[model samples]
Target: MTFPELVVFDLDFTLWDCGGTWCDCLRPPFLKKEGQFFDSDGRHLTLYSDVLAILDDVDDLGLPMALASRTERPDWARELLKLFGIQDRFPYQEIYPGSKVKHLKKISDLSRVPLDKMLFFDDEHRNLADLRPYGVRCQHVASGMSEELFSEGLELFA
Candidate 1:
């Protein structure tokens, strides 16, 4: 296996704390609960060390990353990215509110990057299964997501 030149991250449960639901991170203001991601000054907050570390490793490798989420609001997604100070890390971040299966295909096609050259880090198995036909590898980020898995993934990208 070889490392890919690009990696795609699923935003909701994968990278951000969304109250245990998909799209909870970037839900529209009208749909979000009070203080969903509010910080001390009432600004929205992102995820934990997961976000920083992921970006750091990707940056060290000089690899391209894509934020692939079912988030409906593009503006909110951009805001969250900026809040994390990682807005410059990603060259292509897309918000796909509809079926992720379709979006994954579209992203790969639009980027002109082969599916085999991309690794998807998502918590959902169904979404990963849907991309199997495209030959894209998926890493399930459960509570056990660890450095071993991370290194193992690097093997695929290599």
Candidate 2:
């Protein structure tokens, strides 16, 4: 039976269906004032429900799960997770601002898990490309894509 020892996720686009570049709406407020930003559409996005369910299932199965993002707002990110009610599913150290490649490498080293045993899902091609050479299982989804990618990602770790 194939089971992933570690599952990592990229935030922004991969988790939010905000209908455009995830960083676009956030950059101005986030970079400038360290404040929050909600586009004209408001906070109307949600991750695929299956993703949450899968996290829960992975927990039940004793698999590890984490989030990795280049975002700097640790507080707000935690609040967002609270909004989604999945904050406890992840570890605090798993949410950090650095190159995803760096964070993933650190995670692998600290956990003593080989890169090949890790599964990473991101909506950006660049992130996947950078981590690919390290032997991490990486999947990249197109910007503004649909739930199909989430399904495919789950299958990789399933």
Candidate 3:
């Protein structure tokens, strides 16, 4: 299967096991103790077990990645990515509290990849529905991103 020019991901449940909403108090320089991520407020976050492998596969495919998160705590999200040592993987991040469409528009503008050339993954069905109208291939990651879903996306993009 061919790959999309850019692959965009949602931060919350799609990537990590944080609550529906993250703690606003989370600060920079987050620590990864044991197998989980922790913020200054002691809020714990854990990436789903499949995330690393899927990310690695995407990296091997040499696809540019971006983040489209409707998270109010963008700083916390950025810090968490840094702590996980994957911040550099996504050079185009639109982390803010707004519609996913806005995030995708920014990413599309920056990457110069047309909306149809973008593939998005998010846990929320609403996000997928919203993006579909723009011709972006959207995948619903109900239980975090998995190898199967990633493969399916690749095939669809192809």
Candidate 4:
């Protein structure tokens, strides 16, 4: 398998489902219940079943990873990531409301990885489309992330 210098992911529906909506839509002060995370509104927050394995796959490949979320509440999303115990996985995080092009530019500048050598995944097609001109291999996640999709993204990058 070939590898990109950086593998970027979007939070929201791409990585986790925040009670059937975006993370920003979920009420904050997130809490844990019965080993599961839930928003104050009792909206369940969880990484998709294949998330850990996909992350592990990237780690096993020794590829650097990042997060690019356009959530209105970066703090809330971060809290959930912390609660989910996966925040440390992404050393580079670009969580804010803006074009993913800016996010990828920032990531490229920070990591010194060229845009062409990067792979990005998100639930929204527009997010990926915006990065097309920059040459980043973009994968639109029709649903939550999965090992199969991740493999396909890597293959596309390769």
Q: How much does each candidate deviate from the true structure in C-alpha RMSD?
A: 4.5, 5.3, 2.3, 0.9
Each candidate's lDDT (Cα)? 0.67, 0.66, 0.82, 0.91
In model 2, which regions exceed 4 Å deviation? 18-41, 143-151, 154-158
Instruction: Please give each candidate's TM-score.
Output: 0.75, 0.73, 0.87, 0.97
Superposed model 4: Cα runs more than 4 Å off? none
User: Candidate 3's error at 92, in angstroms?
Assistant: 0.5
Q: Tens digit of lDDT per residue, candidate 3, span 1-158? A: 56798899987888887633453445545666786777655666777778889888878988889999888788777777877778888889899887889999999899899999998999889899989999999888878888899888888876
Report how far off residue 153 is in candidate 4 (Å).
0.3
How would you encode candidate 2's per-residue C-alpha lDDT over 104-158 as one tens digit per residue? 8778777778887887888778888888888888878665324566456557755
Q: State in Å the error of residue 54, model 3.
A: 1.4
- The per-residue C-alpha lDDT of model 4 at residue 106 equals 95
Compare the candidates by lDDT and give the number of the best one.
4
- Ranked by TM-score, top first: 4, 3, 1, 2
Candidate 4, clashing residue pairs?
A: none
- Candidate that beats the other on lDDT, 2 or 3, i.e. the better one: 3
List candidate 1 stretches off by more than 4 Å. Answer: 22-44, 144-148
